[model samples]
Target: ATAEKFRSISPAEFFYRNKEIAGFANPARALYQAVRELVENALDATDAHGILPNIEVSIERDSVKQYVYRISVKDNGIGIPEKYIPEAFGKVLFSSKYVLRQTRGLFGLGAKMVILYGQMTVGEPAEIISAAINSRRIYSYRIMIDVRENKPIIVSKGVWPNNTGWHGTMVKVAIEGDWSRAKQKILDYIKRTAIVTPYANIVFKTPDGEIYTYLRVTETIPPPPRETKPHPHGVDLELIKTMISETKAQRLIDFISEEFQGVGNVIAERFLTKYGFDPSKDPKTLSKEELELLVKALKEFNEFRKPRADHLSPIGAELIKIGLNSILKPEFVDAVTRKPVVYEGHSIIVEVGIAYGGSIQPSEEVVLLRYANKIPLLYDEKSDVAWKVVSENIDWSYYGIVFPAPLAILVHICGTKIPYKGVGKESIAEVPVIEKEIEEGVRQVARSLKLYLARKQKEEEMMRKAVT
Candidate 1:
């Protein structure tokens, strides 16, 4: 091939072409992701009302043409207003939900992407019907997202004549794809969703006519945690450069001190000391070359491991209590603490909590899933060092460890960033120090359990001996 053929395509075409990458392998998987996005949106809506939500999903096989099916997910959530309907279902489709806290949908592209996938596979537009509580009517629209053209085409729009009040969003998509390959993952997603969102009731109907429903016996849903801002130590060279460029500060030291909240004079001095640069020195006097050297030194300082306590924002004790109580139904709550513990030479923290003496198996007594930030890492055991350590340390014989058992040990890891092994969010690369910290923490908790068991055994033996 000629050298000219090896050149990269124009950025415009590259972006447009790559946008369709979500469809190549299995369009069913993409549909699944889309369904999750819409469901998450619905959940967020109801969550805003501080009410536990009821989300319903239905799959129907349209046998008019083989391999054609319609999937619909409806929720009792706050419906979109008339003015924002077009934006919700059409252009500006990305990131309908935006917050600093860890959430499922950031790009707001989930529901929109579903429409795109539907159009691509079936060559037909998807249907949307939504209504607000205050509105007297429901609005229905048939919409198609033209990815090839980068525009949303409106096929039809009408008002649903419903005198009875209603508030919810219903999206129906017709797509040409087989459902067999996507069955297991859909089931697992529902299961995990049900497990984590213990208060949200979910119902699903498969294409095969199998009906599955997850009902919450409790009325409590974990409130969305507070948002976390970017700490000064976590920002890299590019961020620092951006800060310098956008900031209107007359002096560099003032910019560093005022714009960045955490970097005080002492921390700034420590950072500058390594590069033999003094923070007290005036930034205006420095040339471009000197500024470059300062930026490089700051980047190196950012790489140094900060204390885990200084950086981590773990899920609070109250939220964990809400989750544990809903799942385990614990009667006598003992203790819950999300503390940092040292493992090896590295700085890693393990969020370990206990809900002991429950009416359940000790082995399967609690839930333990490691999280980097607040995202769930659901995957293989080998990659889950937290799982490995807990399994190794806990005495399973006493509790009769079993799958789908009652009681769970909820353990998570919060680092500046978590390293994943592959595309799967479940498998994570093990940091030796972090793993050591986690294992040691598990062992310590296990030791407490062991001591409690020993003491009980001794007391029982003494009573029996005295009676005999």
Candidate 2:
């Protein structure tokens, strides 16, 4: 056999060559994905700082090049600090969203990939303008990615006067893409985003010079999620090792109580005693054998309370009703917010909404809108776990619903850790606990729709009798 040839590559180089992993498989999809990644980042930044999102997105054709467009997104959000701006936008796998909280952008590869794609096609660096919240001045930088080194190369830097007293970020990139093919998906994605996040104000200026604005329907923003300690049930050997390395507590007992949720002084001491580990010993000194034993004991222990669900920020039922009414204009609308459920030690909450009759278009199949952690899932609908639960588990016939029925089903799952089936984050895996919660939540709203339909049929029957 010939000698194998192999070489190591930086994260940037790897993704530069395999752009499909970041959802830039084709020109059309790449354009859509780039816009989505930036918009989602802007929304996340605004949400993190408790600011009502005022995001502006524009797509304009390149002056001299066909099928090339300049995409710009500006948001009134917490801007990136000046020092970290280049790395944040140019380096791959660098992100600030690693905390244990609900977030739209899971991996740090989104915005950087957009810049890299642009560099590969158009040889243009991304322009970034940012003014941190409460800062005195705004800073701008033109930067590009050095794929070989996985680093940012700043081309230019400047400062601007903050005359308007604004705080946010603006990013501009020129990329080779097919706007004609991506226009519809881009518009639909924006519309769906508006429905789900009625509190955000978004404007889109297409390449055709047409501008669309989505006004905020409510001033009330959902409560932001809070970070929480990992639950004891969720901890594995790797996590335990990480905790030991980073923990401030010197004693094993203190470490247990501080690092893991639902573990208090009493429980910690008891656990240590049961596992034959010394409570007063240094947890960092645990041998490999001892660590394995501790992990096994913890997995077997069933006395700990379930993980806290407060880390999850789910959209409530009333807001769901308002959103559906505003967007779908359905005559009858109902929603349900399920109680928190645990899946593999992760806390998850499911919210479902049903809209029937009155302006909602009838179709041969049910219209489904799926969301995870407030981010809309636009593709791979059929394979999603939420779709599976809605199609296979729910009986639409019993509720007087049939093909071409005027109905819309909305399902949103919020959690600290979403079990995504793929890197695209477009679908949820079929975890039994998650599927059951979705089915139950949908059923609750479906019952309300059924009653409304039954009453309407009765009224129609009476009207026909009176006419006779």
lDDT of each: 0.60, 0.89
Count of backbone clashes for each model? 13, 0
Task: Residues 1-468, candidate 1: write the lDDT tens digits.
Answer: 656555555322333354444322365665466556566677666654565778998877777875777889888777887666755765533344553344444545556656665665776777888887777889988887655445567898899665777887888887665678677767766765664566778899998999988887567654543444344544555656666666666555666566654567666666666677656665656667776776666545663343334433454555555655655565433224435643321224455544445664555334554454444454465557676666664555554334454444556565434555633245556667666666655555545555665777799999999999
Give candidate 2's total backbone clashes: 0
lDDT of model number 1: 0.60
RMSD of 1: 6.2
Per-residue alpha-carbon lDDT of candidate 2 for residues 1-468, written as tens digits (9 for 90 to 100) = 899999899999999999987789988999999899999999999975689999999999987898789999999999988888999998898988888888888788999999999998899889999999887889999999999999999999999788888999999999989999999989988888888788989999999999999888998888888888888877799999998999999999999888888888999999999889999999999999999998888877888878899878888888888888888899999999999998767899999999988899899777899999888888889999988977889889988899778889999999888998777788898998988899988888888888888898999999999999
* Model 1 TM: 0.67
